[model samples]
Each structure stands twice: as C-alpha cells, then as structure tokens.
Target: MAQTAGVKPMAIAGRVALERERCLGMTDAERAWRKQWLKDQVLAANEPVHVEEYWKERINPIRRFYRKPLDVLFDKLTPMLGASRAADYRVITGKLGLIAVGVMAIHYYFKYHGNDWTKKGGWRVTRSKPMVLPGQPGFPYKSERSKDSDYADRGYSKSSLFDGK
Candidate 1:
C-alpha cells in the first residue's frame, strides 16, 4: 500500500542510487547506518539542512574563535552605526576581502606568468649609449657588414638561405 502524503518510492530509489557510490567498500553495518542517517536527514520542504552531530562537534570550537569576537564587535557597533549602517559595513568588509584576493591573484599572475607574452633578450635600448650617426663625431666608417652587423642580427639579411655559408 502506498502512502500518498509521505515519502515517495522514487525518492527512496534516487537516494539509494546516490548513496550506492558512497556505500562501496563499507561494512554491512556501516552501510545500513549511513542509509538510515540519510533517511533521517531527508526532511519536508522549507526546512534548513540539519548539521550532523559529528560535524557540529568538530566545527563548534573552530567557529567560536570568530563568532564570539564578531558578535561582540557588531553589538558594540550597532548603537553607534545603527543596524543598517552596521550591516553595510559588514558587506563592505566582505567586498574588500574579495578585492584583496583579486589583487593578490593578479600580482601572482604577473610575477610568475608574465614572461610568456614578453619579448626575450636585448629588445630594450640603453639611454647611456646614444647612437653615433654617420658624418657625426664617433661614427665608424671602417666597419664591414657581416653576420655581426645590426642588419644581419635583426634577421634582415638579403643573402639566399639556399646558399651554403
């Protein structure tokens, strides 16, 4: 006999399918307990998820470190800032934290990954050594063009590549 107002057969089937993976390698007793725990966790619509005893025991102590200080801080601020202003400050603090994380991520990218897009080796000009043009003082007229020439070094040589060096 089917109960129209209670848990459906499909819900049980879905839960079994989901839990099947988790149930693998578990002892028979442990599997049974897990299934029972999951069934108990399933509740009617509009109810918040119930934290299990194990998780609550582990998290409570860690949560207290921030929870107590924040509670006291907000309580003290509520009179001076008012409830709305205090809530705004809380939202602003969260946004500032997100901005800080974004900045750090960008800094990490530029520091570690920026070289991939950048040109390599001797691309920048040195201001200390100004160029000496021909017909001006310190110009080199004795220089013969070769592989060591600026033109050849820049890959603009007119020589045919098929010709052996």
Candidate 2:
C-alpha cells in the first residue's frame, strides 16, 4: 500500500547512496589492486601460450608495470578508506537524504519565487522606485514645474492622461 510505496523509494535511494559512498570510500590500494588484476588478465589473454606459459614469460614485465604503482596507490589509500563501520553506512545514507531534501527545497523555492522577483522584461528591481510608463515624463509631482518645457516638445499638454491631476 502507501507505506510500501514510500518505503520503496527510501530503500532505493538509500542503496544508491550506500553504493556511492562505498565507491567513494574505496582505498587507492584497493583500486590499484583491482586495476592491476584486470591488466594482468588482459596481458595473459594476449600471450601466445598457455596461462602458465604466459605468466612465466610476461610476469616480470607485467609485474614491473602494475606492481609498483599498485603498491604505492594502495599504501596511500588504505589509511583513508580501509575500514567502515556499519553505523557509517547509516550516517552516510542519512546525509544523502538530507542533501537531496535540501537541494530539492532550494530548487522549489527558487522556481516558486524567482518569477516574483522579475518583471515582464525579466528586469529585476533593486531599488524602491515606482515604475514609470514608457513615453511619459518623470515623477509627475516633482517634474510639474518643468512641464511646459519637455512636455510641450513631446506634444504633451496639461490635458494629457499622464499629467497628474
């Protein structure tokens, strides 16, 4: 029912988050070991002889390429991600949910309020000035005295709609 549906999403999200943490927490040593193992497999396949013969022939060169780097990488990484407690997984998953909620809330808030901050032309008002009609004179009360000058030039008169009563 409803409970199961809700639990499903949480479980899926938690698993994904756990997997991400696991990968992120992998030590350089572990990664290097994995990479070298893969490389060894590839080189072995490319050998012209049986597996034993290939290992015997190419072992030295392959070891030279993969072993040293793998050891160095493993040594560096082991200290960082070598061990994780069961509680650590739970904490990481919780953090993942919190992050997801925080991000969604921010996105929602922006989407909801972003339009209110912008005008028809996408212009944002940072000041408390009143909007002026296009082709009209400036603040009517303040510019009243100068009306006969610019107003007359623009063919506007005291009877114009923009002329403040």
Q: Each model's number of backbone clashes?
A: 0, 1
The parts of candidate 1 lying over 4 Å away from their true place are 1-72, 115-165
Candidate 2 ranges with C-alpha deviation above 4 Å: 1-84, 115-165
Report lDDT per candidate: 0.62, 0.53
- The Cα RMSD of model 1 versus the native structure comes to 18.2
TM-score for each model: 0.28, 0.21
Query: In model 1, what are the clashing residue pairs, if there are any?
Result: none
Worst 10 residues of 1 by lDDT: 117-126
For model 2, residues 34-142, the per-residue Cα lDDT tens digits are: 5665565565545555485666586697655745544455456556756343235445655686799999987876555543312333323243446677667774425
For residues 1-165, what per-residue lDDT tens digits would candidate 1 score against the true structure? 356766555555343346556565666766687678778878779676557686667677767675555557777898999989987886687678779999999887756554321335433332244567888987863444444544324333444552334
